[model samples]
Target chain A: AQSVTQPDIHITVSEGASLELRCNYSYGATPYLFWYVQSPGQGLQLLLKYFSGDTLVQGIKGFEAEFKRSQSSFNLRKPSVHWSDAAEYFCAVGGAYGNKLVFGAGTILRVKS
Target chain B: EAGVAQSPRYKIIEKRQSVAFWCNPISGHATLYWYQQILGQGPKLLIQFQNNGVVDDSQLPKDRFSAERLKGVDSTLKIQPAKLEDSAVYLCASSLDGGQGQETQYFGPGTRLLVL
Candidate 1:
């Protein structure tokens, strides 16, 4: 079974500061990775995804993630975060199980203006 | 295109009561999913439907939970004899395909359930 681990439970950053959220996964083979964000009382929105090709993947909302095969990590990053960027972020990985995604416990982001 | 739609934004029921949640997937989407998100945890897959037929429901606690998608477009999930631990946000999602590992799932604003 594939599982995801997010090391951070909560992260706080000042507005305009850079942000990085760490994610690691354990799967038998190369896995499909994704990043999702959830605002309060709102559903999750896709931040980005990494299937194969490029190691660096760009996503909506000025977000990006780098998939490192050697480390089994797909960490989400943003050059500068806004106050509105405060939300919960989740990291997920999918295996051969037909879209069954194993998600990590979310990391709550807090951006202060 | 419009995203997945879910109804009854919030529901509060006593323990052992029954509750149902409705979901309407995006038009033309062939796959629908139901997830349970506990506070401070990521969403857990409860059931999945490829059109009107179930694809995977191994994790579902069938003794208490049941779901159906009769028309292949809309779905409903019901929990009978709800427990306090069942309090969580129920999310609905839809994807364009059911193939293994390619499609992206779009989520709906979840319905919050509180059981006393």
Candidate 2:
């Protein structure tokens, strides 16, 4: 079975600071990776996804993620984060062209001004 | 295009009671999914339907949870004899191709459930 791990439970960053959220996945074959953000009391919104192609994939809201097959990781990064970027981030792994998505425990991001 | 739609934005019920949530997928989407999100965790997939046919329900608690999609368009999830642990948000999503490779899924606002 495929599983995703987000080692950090919470991360605090100041506004305009660089941000990076770690994600590690375990899958036998090539994996489909995704990043999602959820605000308080709201459903998740897709930040980005990596199926195949360039290791680095850019997503909406000024966010990007890199898929590193060597380390079994796909970490999300942002040059400078805004206060509105504070939310719960989740990393998910999916199987071959289907509905199953294994999500990580999640990491809460707090932005301090 | 409109995103996925879910009804009853909020629900409150006593333990052992019954509740149901409705979801309408995107107009042309071929797949619909239901996920449960706890307070401090990521959403966990409960059930998935590919055009009114179940594709996955492995994680669903069949004893107390049931879901169905009719006519390949709308879906309903019902929970009977709910427990305290049942308090969470139920999110509905849909994808055009139902492919995990590249298809993007649109999510609804979700229905928050609280069981006393």
Candidate 3:
């Protein structure tokens, strides 16, 4: 069985400030990881995914996540936040079970100017 | 290319009533997926189809939920005698090839279902 954990339920950051959202997963063997963002009234958009290769992966909208196998974490980070970047973020693990994904609870981000 | 499309952007029904939601995946996409996203929760995979054949449906509640992807194209998910807990956003997603678990899945706007 695979599971994901997002420690932060809600986060608030001012514009131009740095932000980081924590994510951890439990899975057997090497796993495929992904980050998704869901805006108000929209669908879940893929931010980035890590299959293999560089531990640090860059995503759309200036967001990036580092896959730390040692810690079982794939934390999303942004050097600077924008007001429009506010949304809910989710971390998922897959690749072992027919592309089936187990997602985290989600973290809501609020950006203020 | 257009993204996944789902009909009835919003649906309202009472408990014990039946409801159905439709989805049309991207052209030439061989894999389709259905997910349930409850308020304040992440989307949960309900079903996955590979060219009209079910690949995984272990999380689906078979007693009241049924889904079909006939002709390997469009799909519909139905709920009979819906429950209040069934109220959530039904999201449809499609990928180029489902063989690799790393394929990027494009999502639809999702159909909001409200059961009162």
Candidate 4:
């Protein structure tokens, strides 16, 4: 079974500061990876996805993630974060097909002013 | 285009009671999914539907949980004799097509259920 691990349970960053959330996964073969964000009282929104080809994948809301095969990691990053960026973020791993995603416990992001 | 729609927004039920959630997938979407998310945890797949047929429901707690998509568009999930641990957010999502390698799923706002 594929499983994802997010080391940080919570992260706090000042406005305009750079941000990075660590994610690691365990799968026998190469796996599809995704990043999702959920705000208070809102549904989960896709931040980005990595399937094949490029190791770096760009997403909405000025976020990006790089897939490192050697380390089994796909960490999300942003050059600068705004207050609105504060939310719970999830990292997930999926199979090559059928779209059953296994997700991490999630990391709550706090933006400090 | 409008996103996936889920009703009731929130639901409160007592233990041993029953509750149901409704979901309408995006137009033309062929795959729909239901997930349960506990507090401080990521969402877990409860069931999946491809059109009007079940695709995967291996993780669903069959004894107390049931779901159906009769028309291949709208879906309903029901929990009988709910437990306190059932308190969670139920999210519904739809995708253009499933069983493919790279389908992006759109999510609904979710229904928050509190079992007392």
DockQ of each: 0.78, 0.67, 0.77, 0.83
Whole-model Cα lDDT of every candidate shown, in order: 0.94, 0.92, 0.94, 0.95
TM-score of chain A of each: 0.97, 0.98, 0.97, 0.98
RMSD of 1: 0.8
Predicted candidate 2 versus true structure: per-residue lDDT over B1-116, tens digit per residue: 77888999999999999999999988999999999988877889999899989988999999999999989999999999899999999999999878655677778999999999
- Residue pairs in clash, model 3: none
The numbered model that scores best in DockQ is: 4
**Cα distance off (Å), candidate 3, residue A91:** 0.7
Model 3 lDDT per residue over A1-113, tens place: 88999999999999999999999999988999999999999999999999999999999999999999999999999999999999999999997447888899999999989
lDDT of 1 by residue, B3-114 (tens): 8899999999999999999999999999999999999899999999998889999889999999999889999999998999999999999999867785789999999999
Clash pairs, model 2 backbone: none
Quote the positional error of residue B65 for candidate 1 in Å.
0.1
Q: Could you give the DockQ of candidate 3?
A: 0.77
Task: Compare the candidates by lDDT and give the number of the best one.
Answer: 4
**What would the per-residue lDDT of candidate 4 be over residues A1-113, giving only the tens digit for each residue?**
89999999999999999999999999887799999999999999999999999999999999999999999999999999999999999999998889888889999999999
List candidate 1 segments past 4 Å from native: none
Instruction: Please give the TM-score that candidate 4 achieves against the real structure.
Output: 0.99
Candidate 2, residue A55: CA error in Å?
0.3
Q: What is the TM-score of chain A in candidate 4?
A: 0.98
Better of 3 and 4 by lDDT: 4
